[model samples]
Target: MESRPSVARPFYSTFADLYDHVVTDPVGPWTEAVEGALASRGVERGTLLDAGCGTGRHAAAFAALGHRVTLLDASAELLAVASTRCPGAPAHLGDVRDPHLPGSFDVLTCRGVLNDLLGDADRDAAVRSSARLLRPGGMLALDVRDVGRSRERTDDTPRSTTVHRDTGSAVTFTHRSRWEDGLLVVAEEHRERSPDGSVDVQEFTFRMRPWTEQEVHERLGRAGFADVVTGPGVGGRWDRLFVTAVRRA
Candidate 1:
C-alpha cells in the first residue's frame, strides 16, 4: 500500500470539535441521502465500517439501527469524539488511504471523505481499501460533492457557507480554483469566531477530477463492485452526488 498523505491528519484533528456543527446542519443533504440509501437497499442492520467516520455521527446512527460499527479515521481527536458518542463500537485511528484493519463488514459507508484527499492514486487507494474490507455481496455507500457545478470564480465571495448555532457564529468560506493535470483544484479557507471573541481560521484544499456518471460506473465495476447505481444529486444546489454499489461474490 502507498504511504498515507500528510493532509489527512490536520483536516480532521483541528476540526473534530466543530465537525458535527459545521457539517450536520438541519438542511444538510448528505445525512438524508445516506439514510435513504440504507433504507432503499434494505440494510436493516449488520457489521458496518465507517471509513473517515469523523465525529461518528453516522456511526452512532448506524449503531442505533442495530449494526455493529467500526469507525475508522485518520485523526485521533475525531476518533475521541466518535468513541464518546458510540461507546460500544470500536473506533480505530487510521488513514483511509491505507486502512490496515482486519475483518470484513456487511456495509461500508464513507461520507465527505473522498474529495478531501487529493490525486487519483490516493483516492483510488482509499476506495480499494474500503472494497477489500467488505464481505461478498456487501454494499458500499459514499457521498462526494460535485465540484464540477461549484462556482469557480476567483472573487472573495463565499462559495461555501457553514453556520455554527451553538456559538452563534457564521463561517463564510471562499474557494480559489486552479487546473492541475486535468484535475480542478479548489482551495478553501474557513473564517469563524469562537465564543470568546477569538477568531479561528482553517485552510483545506481538494482536487476534483473530471468524473462523469459513466466514469463512476466504470471505476466501481473495475473495483469488483456489481450493480453500481448513481443516485440523485443531493445538497439542494447540486453540491453532492450520491453513489451506491454492491460487492460481487
Candidate 2:
C-alpha cells in the first residue's frame, strides 16, 4: 500500500471537540445526498463502515436507519465523540490508507477524508483499500471537491473565511493552485476556535492527477466497481462531485 505525507495532528487531537461549527451543516444536505445515493442504488439496511467518520454523526444516522455501523477515524478525540454519540457502534482509530478493519461491510462511507491526505500514490492506495473493504455487490460512497471548478474561478486569489458562533468557532481555508511532482495540489484548512480563544487548525490537501468525469469513471472501473455516477453537491460546490461505486461481483 502506498503512503502519503501525514497531515498535522493538532487538528484531529485538539480541534476535534469543536470540529463541526466552522463548516457548512453536513446533516441536512450531505446526509440527504448520501441517503439518496444509497437508495438510488437500491442499498437497503445492512452493515456499514463509516471510514474517517468524524464524531459518529453519519454512523449514528446509519444506525438509526437500521444499518449496523462501525465508525473509524485517525483521531482518538474524534472517536471518543463518536463512541459517546453512538454507544452501540464500535469505533476504531486508524488511518484511512489501511483501516486494519475486519469484516466486509455492506456499505462504506468516507467524507472529507480523501482530500486531506496528500500524495496521489497514497490516495490511490486509500481508494483501493476502501474497495477491498466492501463485500462483492456492496457500495462505497465518498465526497470530494471539484478541482475543475477551482480552475474556473474568476478571482485567482485563494479564499479564506471564518465562522465564530456561541457554541463553537471554525475557519475555512483554501489554497491556490500549486503543482508538486507533476500532480496538482489543492488544500483547505479548517481550524476550531475555542471559547477561550484557542485555535486548532487541520489542513486537508488533495493531489489529483488532473481527473475528468470520464477519467474518474475509468479509474472506478479499473478498481472493480460498476455503475459509477457523479452528482452535484447537496450542500455547495465544495462537495460538487459525489461519487458512488458498487463493488463488482
Candidate 3:
C-alpha cells in the first residue's frame, strides 16, 4: 500500500483527471436546461461564461450550439483540460468569489460551485462577482444541492466506483458523506491499482452547504439580481435546486 504525501494540492488537482470517470453526466441535458432558461429571456445565443467549468464539457456543449463560451476555473489542471476541450473559447484561471475577468457576458452558468463556499461572506462575494461579470439584463443560472432533499437522500454510507484506464491500470473511488451543522462533509478515497500489482491511495475531504431555493433567491436578490426563478433538478438530480436570475438593468 502506497500512501500519497499529506501535503495539500489545489482543490480538484488530483480529481481533474478522474473527473469524467466520477461525474459521468452527459452535457446534453445540462446545456439544454441552461439554454431553456436563457431563451425564456429572449437570449438565443451570445457570450456565455461557464464559471467553475470542470473539464469544459458543458462549455463545449454550449459552443456547439453556437454560443460563444468562456471557461473559468481556479484549478490550473482542470482549466487546462477545459481549454483543450474548447480550443476556441477563452479560458481564465480565477475564483468566482472575485473573478477579475475583463469581459462581460450575456449569460453565466455556475453549477456546483457556490455550495463549495462555506461562509456567508464568500458566498455573497461570489454572487456579487457573478453579477459584476455580466452585462445588464444578462442571465445567470446556477444549481445548488437542496439541503432538505440532500439530507433525506444521504445515508452516510460509503459508495465506490472503479474506472479502468487504457494504460492497464484501474482506479477505485470511494466516498462517504455525513451531515454536520447544516453542512455535508464528504470524505473521499481514491485507490489506484497498477497492472504490476502495486497500489496507491489518495484521500480528500471537503464540505458543502446546500441551499434552500428561497435562500438562494435572497442571495441573488441582494446581489442586484432580479426576476429570479427556481426549479428542482433541472440538471437531472432531484437533490439539486436550479435557479435563474437576471442582472437588474
Model 1 TM-score, all chains together: 0.76
What candidate 1 gets wrong by more than 4 Å, as runs, is 1-11, 27-44, 151-156, 159-206, 235-237
Give the per-residue lDDT of model 3 (tens digit) for 32-103.
Answer: 888888778886689999999989989998899898999999889999999999998999999999888997
Query: Best TM-score goes to which candidate?
Result: 3
Better structure of 2 and 3 per TM-score: 3
Error of 3 at 188 (Å): 0.2
- The predicted structure with the larger lDDT, 2 or 3, is 3
Error of 2 at 219 (Å): 2.4
lDDT (tens digit, per residue) of candidate 2 on 165-186: 5575544444555655544665
lDDT values, one for every candidate? 0.72, 0.73, 0.87
Model 1, span 1-249: residue lDDT tens: 122223543345655677666565443365566667778777556899999888888788778767899999877998999999999888788888888899999889887677766676876787788789998888898776554553342233446656564557655544567766656676767666666666666677666664556766877787788878875566663555678988888
Model 3 scores a C-alpha lDDT of 0.87
Kindly report which residue stretches of model 2 are placed more than 4 angstroms away from their true locations once superposed.
Answer: 1-9, 153-211
Candidate number with greatest lDDT? 3
- Any residue pairs clashing in model 1, and if so which? none
Looking at candidate 3, the ten consecutive residues that score lowest on lDDT are 3-12
